[model samples]
Target: MSVQGTPDELVEILRETVVSLVRRDGPDLSARQLGVFLTVYLGEGPHTVRGLAEALNIGKPAITRALDRLEEFKLARRKINPADRRSVHVQRTTRGAALLREISVTMAEAANPQRTAGTPTGSQQGLKP
Candidate 1:
């Protein structure tokens, strides 16, 4: 489904979602690491470090660093490409999928906080006067 909102509203949604992520107990991914993780999980793959760097318009070393962080969290993994042993393929893990689901829920709630149980009303949140 398509979600439409004013620019301010969109930014508020992003802010709220990020705040929720920050307050959560799991790994706190940097912007680059999160971008790389999303790209791998959301995009169709055969994803290699080279391909990610190209897709993201980032350097290979930066991509490698992001992948390293992801691997440390067990959110993604690299496997040697059998046909080309020199290449490494990025793969998603169950933990990564679960994290994505959590993010989706957070975004949804942020987008409609009034509908969420125990969420303060606009006036209470100081969004309305």
Candidate 2:
């Protein structure tokens, strides 16, 4: 059978799935905390707090607070940028990679809720959905 919900509804489901995954395994991270970690995890270059704030459209202070939590969990680290001592870049640690992979698998399972039945309803184009 074709999926019943609008694409947006499906997207919301995926978002909720991600949120739940983060909440469950990443006990130290809030949804926002996971979001910041993911940003750096996926970025080509190091991600600065300012860049994360800009990317997420959140205030710097909010990003800082999230970063603090991630650092506490050992999933992320604040490193001094070599080119700029005063600047800090966030990097995902081995622990963070493991967490990301775990969350990714959980999200994949969530989005493809019908996996066991042989039908998958993953039509959304991007990762956030």
Candidate 3:
């Protein structure tokens, strides 16, 4: 489902969503790591380090570092491809799926505060008075 809002509204939603994530007790991912995790989980894979680097327009080492953090958190895993021993495939984990769900719920709540029980109203969430 597509969320339609004015640019400022969208920014507020993003800000609120991020702030919620920051407040939660869980693995806090960097922007790059989040991007990598989303790409691996949300996109069709057999995602590889080389493929991720190319897709994200980053270097392999950066991808490796991101993957290392993801693996450390058990959000994603790297497996030596049986078909290509030289390549490693990035795999999604249950923890990663749970994180995705959290993000989705947070974004939804941010977009529609009144729909969420105990959430502040839009005006209280940085909407201009």
lDDT of each: 0.90, 0.76, 0.88
TM-score of each: 0.87, 0.72, 0.87
Query: Which segments of candidate 2 are over 4 A away from where they belong?
Result: 1-9, 12-28, 116-129
User: Which pairs of residues have clashing backbones in candidate 1?
Assistant: none
Better of 1 and 2 by TM-score: 1
**Candidate 1: C-alpha lDDT:** 0.90
Please give, for residues 1-129, the per-residue lDDT of candidate 1 as tens digits: 578999877877777777788899999999899999999998989899999999999999999999999999999999999999999999999999999999999888878857655976445787753
Of the candidates shown, which would achieve the greatest lDDT relative to the real structure?
1
What are the clashing pairs of model 3?
A: none
Indicate the residue-level lDDT of 129 in model 1: 31
RMSD of each: 3.2, 7.2, 2.9
lDDT of 3 at 85: 94
